[model samples]
Target: MELTDLATIRAVLKRHGFRFSKSLGQNFLTDPSVCPRMALACGADESKGVLEIGPGFGVLTKELSERAGRVVAVELDESLLPVLGETLDSCRNVEVVPGDVLKLDLAGLLKEKFGGMETAVCANLPYYITSPVLMRFLEERLPVASLTLMVQKEAARRLCAPPGSRDCGAVSVAVSYYARPKILFEVPRTSFYPQPNVDSAVIRLDVLPEPSVRVKNEKAFFALVRAAFGKRRKTVLNSISSGLGLEKSEILTALERAAVAPSARAEQLSIGQFAELSNRLEELKNEQ
Candidate 1:
């Protein structure tokens, strides 16, 4: 069956008595070209294991199964389970697991399903849960080598944005600390069965061996990052002092010690600079 075909998808949904749920962000891909391109971009191969999220109708699941040795697709919508079963029947390598990716024990899941093979994630992610899903992938520090995701266009820009770019956010900095993100291509809103309001872009994040910078405390480093960007309009000095509940003088001193300009905004500093600032702040906190 041509899973990406609009008529076929509608027929499958009708046969299964399926209805699209806006809350679930159930937009099935209708573009045959997009899934193949996403699979190729993911660099999936016979030696790798692929974990796909939100495998609506198994279009992308089938594509990944063709390239990877094993594919485990996590679908939160229970109604789609049988539909996936039917669509992915011939793809002996693909397994559709019904559960929320956010709540799953990813490390355990990876160990069990992808033990002997290198792992990667390839999915046309639900826009509503994009940040949480990506955060789980990054914060867990999973063994996955890379993630190739189709996300909202604006989100793609923010994820791949450089430190000083206007598109950069706290999440952008956090993502950069974990991986090298780049936007590979754009998919029009019309590419889906129920077209989304916004266009989407395919982004690939190659996981780094270690964090981009050295910090005394990982918690303190991310806390500082969150504090820095908490008030977008404020200078780094102001934001840190207010967000972290530190005296402005103390924040200024830490910035000075780190050789970062106190006048710089959070977005103006690179991950390394933030690390330095965070380490200096930690030293001051210890002295007090």
Candidate 2:
């Protein structure tokens, strides 16, 4: 809210004598308004519990504690304990847990924090752990309401990308299978104590119970999708052949049956088309 946040963040670090580590991506959001926007984008409810990752200075945690029914903030940097304690002390609803968010079983942690509370996630995430953190929640298959994260703007574009875009890769398809993504807001580079070179955005992902398609074998379907995008310039047939260790003729036949052109590339196929290809693969497997 004030320049004091930068000063307070620094003073807290000085009193405790802590230095920010570059490897950990330790950029703290000093602008206080960003927290409530994050909570809102995340759909934080007084009745729903939230798990936040990388609560560097707990600036966001302070805001979340007011809006959510319960807030469990996972902080990897132990250096900010005194800072977090000072900020979150008045807020009995917030509990700061010191641990690497990647190693923590998030769903299990949420349950432990407040049993039977509908869970959601809100975080000012570290850029280094972006993929792993996003994948963990997206693949968890838990009862989370949604995940609203502050990530690199580039990552946001990738997550919300449509088919046929440069950003549409394996991660894009994998994300689409889990939930619909939307970029809610863009954060300026100057908002942090030490401004990161890259700008960031707040993106929300509404978790789905299952994929939008009716595929028999979801695992194999995703494998096929990943394989298809493994090489961007290659045709679907060639990409899949390399991945599945099948011949070009075999891939062509499968594509023909699915009504997809073998000349098409991975990014050209929609989720349903991919499912269709997967179904045809099953038929081919059965025939053999």
Candidate 3:
């Protein structure tokens, strides 16, 4: 049942009569070493409860269960449950749950499976659903200590991007608000079976105890960020004004009050500046 190679994986799939579901993003990892390395990078150990998304064939689950105290491996495909159970039989620390990760209640899951233990997440994310999944864990208020996932190389670059770069966007701003993200490793396309056409990278996101910026009405702050970056090529003042429906003069004054440069583009502004702009906008509203 070892997923060290495609032949074994195919054998296990056939033995269980499990058909791969492409719609669920079912590209399984064939690399023998990546699982162990990902587990180690996640800082998983006997005290940690690891949340695994899409544990196809339980190859990574085996390594995670070995290193982590408990593993709540959520799989979208119920067809793979029998296969995972057989493959991960020896590991008592593993629990394979059948559910769509997006629809499942993460907080409730943590209470039921992890209890009071701190946790980390490790997943070989489906390429098509990468952004949504990453946003769910990082921004949807899951109480995880850290997140380590394999994402498309292009996505990893955009998520962890710095200000003033072409890759930087609303996601970068949103992600930076909650955690300090870093690229952990680059993985070649060959690592996965049915090899993907593009390269991928592993990123480690260390959750911050407090937001990078302490702003009044945090939700509004992100709303403002979304507005600012809504039109990438537009000037900061123009985009925010158009997106938020604020007067150009008011937007300019708020930008100035925030101590942001007048000519700055949304892509050039840091997360701190976005927070400052939110605070300034509130002040402008109060003054009126």
Candidate 4:
């Protein structure tokens, strides 16, 4: 079946009585070239297992099944299950799991589905839930080697931005800590069946074997990062002091020990600098 064919997709959805859910951010990809590129970006092959989220109409699922050894696609909307059954009927390697990817036991799912095969994730993610989903995968430190995702073009810039770059945000820092992110390509708003207002871009995140920077406490490290970016206009010292409820004198001391300038804001600090500051602060707290 030509899964990307707009007419074919309409017929399938009509037959199944499926309707797009606005709340779920349902925008099915109708561009033939997109799925192939997205599937290939992840470096999936006969030796690899793929975990797909929101396999709308099984378009990308079909492409992945053709390239990867196995594919487990998790769809949040149950109404699309039947639609997928018909579309992916001939794909022997694809299995559709009906549930929210965020809530699922992904480690268990990957273990059960892929076994020891090298795993990766490829998905045309919904714009609204993009950050939470990406964070879930990164924070869990899943066994996957990489993730190739389609997200809003603006979000792509933020996600791929360097830690100290102007486009960087708190999420950007967190993502950089876990993986090396790069923007692969862009997809126009018209590429979907129901066109969206914003253009989209594909980003590939190569998971690092170890974190980009190591700190004494992972939880405290993230908390510190959140605090740093919590007030973008404030200096890092002030933001950290206010967000973490620490004394300005103490934060100033930690910043000095880390060789970071007190006047610098969160956006001016790199991942290494953040790590250094976090470690120095922890040391000062221990001395108290």
lDDT of 3 at 230: 96
> Per-residue lDDT tens digits of candidate 3, residues 144-240?
9998999999999988998888999999988899899999999999988777788999999999988888898887898898988898888899999
C-alpha RMSD in Å of predicted model 3 compared with the true structure: 1.3
Please provide, for model 4 over 69-106, each residue's C-alpha lDDT reduced to its tens digit, 9 standing for 90 to 100. Answer: 99999999999999999999999999999999889999
* Candidate 4 TM-score, C-alpha based: 0.98
Per-prediction TM-score to the true structure, in the order listed: 0.98, 0.95, 0.96, 0.98
Q: Give candidate 2 regions above 4 Å deviation.
A: 1-4
lDDT tens digits, residues 185-213, model 2?
A: 99998888788999999999998877777
Put down candidate 1 lDDT per residue, 89-139, tens digits, no spaces: 999999888899999998999999999799999999999999999989999
- Candidate 1 Cα misplacement greater than 4 A, ranges: none
TM-score of 3: 0.96
Candidates in order: C-alpha RMSD to true structure:
0.8, 1.6, 1.3, 0.9
lDDT of 2: 0.84
CA lDDT of every candidate: 0.93, 0.84, 0.88, 0.93
| Regions of candidate 4 where Cα sits further than 4 Å from its true position | none
**Candidate 2, which ten residues in sequence have the lowest lDDT sum?**
1-10
lDDT of 3: 0.88
